[model samples]
Target chain A: MTEAVDDATLVQMFETMALVAATDDALRAAISAGSATLAYYSPRGQEAVAAGFAAALRPDDYLVTTYRGLHDQIAKGVPLRPLLAEMLGKAEGTGRGKGGPMHVSWPDVGLMLTTGVVGSGLPIAAGLAWAAARQGEGRVTVASFGDGATNIGAFHEAANLAAVWGLPVIFLCQNNGYGEHTAFADHLRVDHVAQRAAAYGMPGVTVDGNDPVAVHDAVSVAVARARAGEGPTLVEAVTYRLFGHVFGDRMTYVDPKELEAAWKREPVTRFRQTLVEWGLLSEADAAAIEERSATTAAATLAEVLELPEPGADEVLTDVVAPAGADATKRTARAATKVVVPDGSVEVSVRSAITLALDEALESDGRVVLLGEDISDSGVFGVTKGLAAKHGADRVRDTPISEQAIVGAAVGAALGGLRPVAEVMFMDFLGLCLDQLANHAAKLRYMSGGLTPVPMVLRTAVGGGLQVGAQHSQMLEAWLTHVPGLKVVVPSTPSDARGLMAACIADEDPCVFIEQVLLLSRKGVIDSTPIELGVADIKRPGADVTVVTYGRQVHQALAVADALTSKGVEVEVLDLRSLVPLDEAAVLESVGRTRRAVILHEAVVTGGFGAELAAGISEALFGRLVAPVLRVGALPAPLPYARGLERLALPGPERLLEALEWVMAYEG
Target chain B: MLLRLPKIGMEMTEAVLAGWLVDDGATVVKGQALYEMETDKVTNEIESPAAGRLRRIAQEGMTYQVGDPLAEIDED
Candidate 1:
């Protein structure tokens, strides 16, 4: 522990520790009193780590921490009252109570993100540091996570990438000696988490987390290195969790002797004794702060619990950008009325993405291209020539970590840069879904529109060419299901360019799904811009309406062409945009055609087509000529054989059969 | 010699003569654009194979199949 610290800073650190310990006590009391029922991750013994680490950071510096981040938030200068209100689920809370305790984000104080998912904060910290570097600001980002996080892929990616990119970030590992009651020694093989930092070519330091001054001194070194553009530093604050991981955990698995020893050396009381011995803080002075902090924390918790819950109207307000003048303004900025290329300038989907990404990169200074293989022109040639054209800084190639690729994008977007992160394939989304579903999808609503996550996650979707089960899954339904996300799937090249431009201009998070089959399929792209949430009529007719998107759009068109010879006029509506669903276009087409057929390449059980079918049926329940017919792949993992794959996905033959079924239905 | 549109894709048997890039009877060099063709797969420029005075053999905006000559190039 560093004994050379000044009295004023020591006094400040003592106060921070007292406040956090008081908050922990109040939360336990609230749970006991039945005033609050939310699962709380107590940071009782870990208060010294936050107090010490935060002492060296300025208000403009960023922080990404885990759910056990109340102390970190308090140390970063988040007001105790609003934070307590949030933990109590008050509308006046930091996240307006939408985020609860686990997902608090106070960008105003540089407490950028808090997530419930383990090991996810490191990548997000990397992104904030990257954004700071891009802005030419000397702001350093502190990423605090558990010792268990060191074993995760995101930690490795963040440590390596931040070092390689020279991002100003300090990777803070708060070693609490347990990952949800399992001892650190059992979960991790290394003696100390800091030792792993050497592999990433960064300085590693381990400090006594029980001592506030020691933590502050250690973090100060990292903070200085980062501000000097010396890249990232890894700091492991070895501490113990005196309480259970969550409010109600029985904690029966821990060694009772170790627990007794840790409790005897608890940070708050021990720090007070140290201050008294140094003659800097009198025993009376430390007692008064502890006494006052306890009263405030408990009283605020009780008061905020009585506060009114969020109103029902609050549900729809922050799903996307706020409606009203801003919606109109954003729509004007994003929409470019649909225009076609003058001549048949054929373009494949891959080349179209390359051109669109290039245009997006050229037009906006804030726009950044991030993902794996993007610098290598992408796996399918989608980003060919982009890294060279835009320069390496703008078109960044990241390590093979989906969590970092996505989590960092969310951070970068919140930090003022428009980052477009790619996860290579749709299946890879599983590895990084916490950032996408929990962070990016909820930040706008959670922050009560205070922060806009204006970033795009471009991933390849659908199955074909014999790429088996894991590689060949169409998961647009999962993304479209997330309320805060805008899902876009462009079947044709023109739509790919225009819709991509609109998505980039949109002031919300978007998941842009590109098809593998459409990469080679050539088509004419008009120079005219297309707006989002607008569907295009690929084949106009007055018979059955076939609704589809992405790869299946072409099959619907082929079916319509084949039916043309039989004098059966079938209309195909390519639902290019999924989330801001062009319900009007779908209804208008179906209203004219009278019969509806919804189709997709995903399995029928939980596919996006099911939602479209239900919605179309409800809108035109009595006015329809027949029930909405849905044609999709069977319920099974996509197999490897050509015959099995064909049978698994909806194709021209399947569409033709479904068309005949819908056309013949009299009800 | 007839300057014909080449096959761009296996599925394409015919294509629309989108427009002519050069005037009729104009002297053209090899690789110079004579006209453009829009097939089901992609849009491509039909370049002159030989340097010659070009003569229009087919009208613009007409549907022509593979091996169907669109212009006659007279070597000068």
Candidate 2:
């Protein structure tokens, strides 16, 4: 009515706000009556923020919101029946009863994500904006969070990255007076959330969240700037939560006077009275609107409460792409077509990797590369010349924001780009493990087959480089332990090239770890396409089996050759992929040899070798000639001195000792 | 003598003839940059293997498979 929109749009915003209020009241009442048993975050006073921003956006624009997003979800056009059904854990819900309240995602209504982690959705929203920018669709993405989220590192990383890339995204902060139990002043030092946007070189605006028209105008201006390719904007809408943070909270920490004042200025009441004063609606008409919203909310909840619960078998479904298909038992398949070259070329592992990335980028339009200094080919020169070859957009160089980089890659994958993001060192995964382990690894399973995050996080693991404790750890065991994430380690140049292509084409998220010690190792790379979860028998022998991967594979091969001179033939099995641990191949080789030794570069304590040894013993219990032994580095942080570094890792002598012990087993 | 498209990468099967550096019927020596072929987003300049009168058989902007004949050269 003021200036943002015509009378019809204002009425539409009021209608959305009314529906949100009616649903909130009905849900709270149901919880009080014991009809619903779930933890709920009440958005009683934030209806105007949701309604206003949603009114400013097109139905097709992407929206990433937080756990307190029932109002946002309804305003963004999520159907009342499914939204209510989800609240009751029904099978017909948006997430098929798997995501519950915190992890809900219904891409059909442009509600791309509802994250449970505080401030985690910001980086993912930036990634979605990147994809939209690439697709040349003027679709702007909105990331909705509370005032407290602005204090998190992800908020800064995402805002800066979005501004640097000129991405189309709006950071919508609903400053509802408190961050959970703590007041805003206690959590954040900034007076206004929007004021921090200046640090990221983006426009900052604070609006009256209680006035739907003001919010609409602010969001409209931000959306316009985004569509015009002016990059991201920070919009902080000031409001208050009328109730306690959660449904069951007694509000002992809140001041009685402040609570009462907030209730008097509740958004639904204020906006309704404003509409009446502006002559946009009569008192009877306003009453009818409220009546219609309440009736719809009640009817939907009643029907949803009767719906049956999700089947118990849903626990195993949608854990990875090709929903419900077991990755371990999946047939070895090539997702990318391979064209065998006429001849093999001798190249280093690094060069082979560059070739694989180049091939994927040239052949597949969806393939993209992003990492720190990747445009300069990274620290190892693996991605050298790629930025110039594929253009900066495809071979992107990101700031040292690991969380934002990986989160954005996950978001880009959801938006249909086969993004291959690189973390400079595998040890740096700690900085971004939440995005990798929580969001990227669980999005497919949490979305209940509604979303798939098909991206590759390539990292380097070095043990003998003497980079000390932080940068020289082989953390593959940590990654392999996580379900829904495929782990790939290439021992040869051919495997590196082939597996890189396969991982990019893979439908599930993958962690590709490159061993720094093998980057310059020369080998003949051929055009043979390799399928994931398949193991290669480098040397076939019967006396014993030496199972290894990465740089240790070469050491095992050398020991096998040396043992051949002593009349003991050792079989070397290289596991190119770790997660889908080629159980059949491991069993076949160990069963033949009747003796096995697992070798790896990681520490002996709790290394991936432990998993392999246990698995081998359990399967080949009585038939084995000797007990399986695991050879690995000493259980200590790798030292900076070369001698200490070499001492900690498995050397040729260690491999020979393990081989001879298995060969000389008397048990 | 015949010049054929060579495999660039282990995965490359076909490449686009981006452009010809030397015109048709131009005499070129061995190791001289002759034409541009693009594969896997990389553009490589193919050199003449032998000096001869070149006859451009493959047109510019056409894609050819590896080992496909691109041009014929009458040896000097």
Candidate 3:
């Protein structure tokens, strides 16, 4: 026995490894027997790596793993009953059958995240470690991913950030000679996954994954260093996958000779023989442990197979946390609004947003700000003087790494912080869409309400500005389309402060897009925050209902003003938030006006105006005077040329024309 | 010398004249920040291209296409 591990610890590792092997055997058997249908990634060969590392970590420490994470979950103390039931898609499963075998999380036992995307766990692990570092708990996070994951951009970004911040995270790469069907040699140019750590200025170690003692020793050292705040480490465990990538995969690409050779050194058998040779466990005792594990796994599988599946109601239960969840935690701070006798104070949109951020940061200690150049007041000055007031740790200036910026914020949110992340430009969301859309937007639903990502992604959209094609885009429709995300756009400075406050306090991920043109626009704002999914009637009239948001609200109001002098009154409804759209307000307005016009800055084709028009047509049908009109940019990218730009966008003249057309309409 | 609007960023094709720091017919030194233009929500100070008397062509609060003359500098 290795001096680093005692007799009991070594035997405990064997016991955990045996449970993983037995669970794999039972699950594959059930799948073959047509009793439990699942997409299983068997961890039959790489059991020792999970067991060894899990043994080294405290129960309270965090674990982030990939889709092929059954072994890791088992070793980290996820109960066999619930784990098996989850794989079987039972109601009592970890994710309430929402996340199948590919995704599972049990925070009670510290198995925080099991990501379906490759290399996604690394950045989240870094975030968890960031929270751990702040908590001063000396707890470390272990992220387990395959050798192929090391090649992804998220791996590089997370590794560099973890090193730079001295985050207590362990990157455990199980180099099982293959990344799915592709051989490791075919995928990576480097000799070892650990070699990449040198570029990030962290310790990198390659160990024999087959030997539990070796993995345990390496992980223990890393844990000790991390506990001492020394920084993160990358440990590459060399092993082999005995089975195919998935249960039904033929694996025809694998050489028979190599497969035969890998089976001979299979971890479970090799470790059993080693225990027998050391005299720590006799042949009979080892057989008993294996038998016990197999029997327990079989019995648990039988019990889970009979459990009921998640009900249909579970589909909508966990999409978002209940409203006022933010109020429970937020302490009172200085009111952001400057209320005079008129119950409002005139301020620019930029100043209003700054006030909202300042209030959020002041009221809630968990609130943090992360973005590019934000520490030095950001490009637009909305985050001006925040870093100096909140400290560098709370308001951080990140490298030009969008994926890491958003991914780390998600992880921080999952790790119990209300992160307000900025992507600088709306066009740059493509760089971090996976983190924002897949991870942040779906975590609560995937976890079946077990975890809520109370975070906000703040980005600036510049449609009016002739910043060419790429930089000028108001992609609010894209965000509102996402199920678990709340999309908010504020027209006036008052709505900006109110909506920004609501976003910070929301229990779901929110996309707050600031129309850059309105940054300098002035309006009166008060402390009363606007509720999400509520519409504000900026100008109430009876001729026609002009439904709009963001920059178009100003155009709609201008048209309303010009028509008012012409003896035609127009009612303008500003949809402050879009996801949980104020359909009642829309219906009431369109019903009274008997006509509607939807205005926005996005292209007319597939713009959010289409949805509004369709909804108004369906609900207020036969009561309107004419077909719903959508006034938006032309079906073309925002042109750089001055004349074309004006011609393309829905200008005040377009709104005026639409208003005149609706007024003259007759059925 | 015509003081056409200089592209501030790779994507910038137009900018709003926040205001001209130097008045019309004012003698401005070369390399001096002569006017402030708003682009992509950021206010940038445009420098005088030559030491000359500035004759303003663009009005405040108006957006000009890139390369459109904002002012003419009469070299002295």
Native-referenced TM-scores of chain A, all candidate models: 0.94, 0.96, 0.97
As for lDDT, the candidate ahead, 1 or 3, is 3
- The weakest ten consecutive residues by lDDT in model 1 chain A span A329-338
> Chain B, model 3, TM-score against the native?
0.94
Candidate 3 residue pairs that clash: none
What DockQ does each prediction reach against the true complex? 0.00, 0.00, 0.00
DockQ of 1: 0.00
TM-score of 3: 0.87
- State the lDDT at A362 in candidate 3: 76
Give per-residue CA lDDT, model 2, range B17-72, as digits (tens). Answer: 99999999899886577788887656777666557888998989999887677887
What's model 2's overall lDDT? 0.86
Tens-place lDDT per residue, model 2, A382-411, is 998888978999999898999999999988
lDDT of each: 0.83, 0.86, 0.86
Backbone clashes for every candidate come to: 3, 2, 0
* lDDT score for residue A535 of model 2: 97
